[model samples]
Target: MTTTVRIATPDEVPILNAIRTSVRENHMTLEQMADYGITPEVIANLLRTTGRAFIANVDGVDAGISIADSAEGNIFAMFVLPDYEGLGLGRLLLAHAEAFLHATGVASAWLEAGAGPGIRAHGFYAHLGWQSDGLMPDGQLRFVKSRAALTQIVAGG
Candidate 1:
């Protein structure tokens, strides 16, 4: 029940890959992931760029992961193991991503989610105050949220 989130180091790619591939929705197989340039080296290189990766643990067990890119102002990725779904780890990880963007002086951040009907991510982003701007050419739903407004909400405005 003890939940914690931390900056993920380069050596933890397996943990990242584990949480990522565990998702039944929007999953990429090992080959597919590498095909998309999502290799361990890329993950490490990304962390050295205008982005960061995070790992969330429940009772000391890795359960989720997220990556936020301040340069792109994007929540590049987020995933949680199915068994960890109901524990609110996704929310915690997302907040870390947003905070990373805000702290880097980004005014807003955006992320892509599966646009298909009945996809929980669409509603999840909306429920978190991310406005659905439009559907992207990639057929993913684009969701945006301004850090200023988010700060206000956190401040009890």
Candidate 2:
């Protein structure tokens, strides 16, 4: 029942994509990913540059993933295998990604989610302290977390 999160290796596009495509929510296929310029080479180059990906393993098996765009201060993606759901791997991976962004000096970070509140990720992000930031021009929901906001809230501002 032990879970671990680690920075994904440079060539983990296949593993990362497998976990991504396996999700029923926020579902995306290989072709759809490619259509969005998320090809394997692009992912690899991102890993080598402005993006960082984290893989979560449960009891020694790869079960989930999180990716962040450092330059954009965005949580680009997070996904857990259906078989690995409910074990809190997604939360752990997300915390790790957020920690990475914080370490890199981002005051705020954001991630897009499905349009409806009924989507599991909507609740997940909300539960993790991400504030709803309304919809993107393309209609996706944007959620953000800000260290500065947290500081202001803590100061009763």
Candidate 3:
């Protein structure tokens, strides 16, 4: 399927929220996502401040969404619909996020993925060549990749 990715606008909160809900329910454990947050207000605020949100449409349908925060070049949120997994969409969105970070003049990107997701995200990061330093206070594995590496990845594609 042909997938199109674009920057998100404020009006896209509901869709973004829905995407967050999907991840929270299917991928993130309640303990990992934390019930205290994930509210509409919180998600909205994140989309507004941290950085940019990008939505991916596969064959004209919303398939996944990701948020890249300029602060520390974090991959704040990344979720793909269950059906859309393994279609290379996740990698596409990640590359988009990395490129966005690189454009912002960051030398590297960092991300934390909770262990409860059942997706072995730490391994996923490793597959992408992201170096894992250790776990965070939230019990999430931390991964970092240099901007040069990500740029070469983006250019190679």
Candidate 4:
């Protein structure tokens, strides 16, 4: 499927929130995700943030979402829909975030993935050559990749 990435507008908050809920539910314990805690307030806050949000569409249908907060030149919150998994859409979203971060003068990007069930997410990152620096607060694993490094990986791929 052809993929397109673009900056998400405020009107796309609901779609983005739905994508976030879907991704969070996939990684959260069933008991915790039972209620599906996404709210418009959360979406509003995210839209108002300093960071950027990206939406990915496959064949013109919304397929994924990614957000990156600029912190010490480190990008964050790279996520994709489960249905879109294994199709390299995650890598596309991540590359978009990295380019955005790098354009904003970030030399590196960092992401956190669940250590247990979320371990699958690590494979996606590692496959792209991101280096794992191990655990972080909340027991998630941390991955660090330089913008130049990711550029090479994506280019080579």
lDDT of 2 by residue, 1-157 (tens): 8877778867889999999999989899999999989998988998999888989988999999989887999899999999989998888788778877776678799999976657989889898899999999878999999955322211100
Which of 1 and 3 is the better model by TM-score?
1
Off by over 4 Å in 1: 151-157
> What TM-score do all the candidates reach, one by one?
0.91, 0.91, 0.81, 0.76
Q: Can you rank all candidates by TM-score, best first?
A: 1, 2, 3, 4
Which consecutive 10 residues in model 3 have the weakest lDDT in total?
A: 24-33
Would you list the clashing residue pairs of candidate 2?
A: none
lDDT of 4 by residue, 105-151 (tens): 66777887776764677887788778998898768788898777754
Residue pairs in clash, model 1: none
lDDT of each: 0.83, 0.84, 0.74, 0.69
Give the candidate number with the greatest TM-score: 1
Score candidate 2 by lDDT.
0.84
lDDT of 3 by residue, 1-157 (tens): 6878888877787776666667632465434445746555665676678677788889988888877887758888788887787787778888888887887778788987765546456667789888988878867778888888774334221
Clashing pairs in 4: none
Mark the regions of model 3 whose C-alpha exceeds 4 Å error after superposition: 24-38, 116-118, 152-157
Clashes of 2: 0
lDDT string for model 1 (1-157, tens) is 7987888877887888888888978887778889978887888888887778889989989999889888888999999998889789888888778877777878888999976888999888888899998989978899999878443212100
Worst 10 residues of 4 by lDDT: 148-157
Ranking 1 against 2 by TM-score, winner:
1
